[model samples]
Target: RVRFRDPAGATRTGEWTDAIECDGRSYDPAAVEVLPPCEPTKVVCVGRNYVAHADERGADVPDRPLLFLKPPNAVAGHGATVTLPTGVAGNRIEHEVELGAVVGERCRDVDPAEATGVLAGYTVVNDLSNRDDQRRETNWVRGKAFDGAAPMGPVLATPEEVPDDATVECRVDGEIRQRASREQMVFSVPELVSEVSRFLTLEPGDVIATGTPEGVGPVKDGDRLELTVDGVGTLQHTVRA
Candidate 1:
């Protein structure tokens, strides 16, 4: 599913195929302003879920999933430009590509085997971070949950549409920065869902970013980022200095 604003200055949501069809009108995708596929109240993110990513950060792999939260204000849609915080000296913002799962219903203490049943679909996410603030704080709120920190969407594909071992990649200014398969994850999607629900109730539209792969790096001003998850779609956004 996709959400966009038509040329007529009206908002519309519909299936995205060759074009966007809404109210008997066929609108060109390029002609409309695309919005995030879902309005997630909070984004539950898994940290160090990829072994190589953990190693690169000089942290040991956790025995269990490390979780964090991103409030709604941090959500940004595809094609949006993310502005880096400049007030703080030595603020280095980096990008981490992740596969985001949109919750389909409200549930808690879900079984791992039935996790997919509560999922609305999947989309691409860029877990932008401020390395300086992250290293200084324990909660990482300023580092990970800044405004427009999570640039997601372009489209949301149903669970059946995505593969069990889909590929996720991030390209910066047309150069490949991170690339890996879901198979490399230390915890599977179902396991992460089950584990997360154990702590809090997941409501409809909540997102779970299932961690990022290795090769994460810094982004300069005016850098274009393309975050892609196989079977979903690519999320394109740019960074402002």
Candidate 2:
């Protein structure tokens, strides 16, 4: 598990086994600063890597893999508030729970069999989206690349601590919305690392957000999004106006 200073300037860590009191702090769990598990230069994400998710959206399953990027500035720590952009009235907002791979070592042209050796850890990530904006613009930048849109953490767990094929699930307001096993992924973690590294160098701390599963849907203000990757931890955030 990782440690972080909440908005109230208190150093709280998820590794601990007890509840942490806020002590009347004005901080909202939905709005907090995020620091990288390790310093990273890039965040690479796979799109539609799950056949069921791709089919649900009428997107074709890729022959290889579709990838995208989220700038480092877009990273938000656990409990960070995700804001809905002004005047994006008709856009639908959705929560995507994904298993994020944290690279532990720098690599280039890595072999799939050796990819796990380079992994630093794992973290739960919510890949927030604005569907209308994405569909209309023909580019994902504006839709998926927004401030605090990528809420990750609670803590990063070392590979030895988390079994590679853990289950990943997403819930909104205590109700399960998306569920899938890592075993269902069209591409394995090692394959992702090997494929991604073939195109670009991967540095320690760089994160690769493996694609979400089926059951993608809308969310609104005041809703709490809980993402859990077994053996890692749960990451919670609330939507705000």
Could you give candidate 1's per-residue lDDT for residues 88-166 as a string of tens digits?
A: 4476899999999999999999999999999999999999999889989999988998899999998989999999889
Q: In model 2, which runs have C-alpha deviations exceeding 4 angstroms?
A: 6-14, 19-39
Q: Say what the RMSD of model 2 is.
A: 4.1
For candidate 2, the 10 contiguous residues with the lowest summed lDDT are: 16-25
The residue-by-residue lDDT of candidate 2 on 37-136, one tens digit each, is 4445777888998899999999898988788888876688767677876666486888899999999888999999999999988888888887888787
What would you estimate as the lDDT of candidate 1?
Answer: 0.93
The residue pairs that clash in candidate 2, if any, are 2-155, 30-80, 30-81
- Candidate 1 residue spans exceeding 4 A from truth: none
Count of clashes in candidate 1? 0
Lowest lDDT block of 10, candidate 1: 83-92
**What is the alpha-carbon lDDT for the whole of candidate 2?**
0.81
TM-score of each: 0.97, 0.88
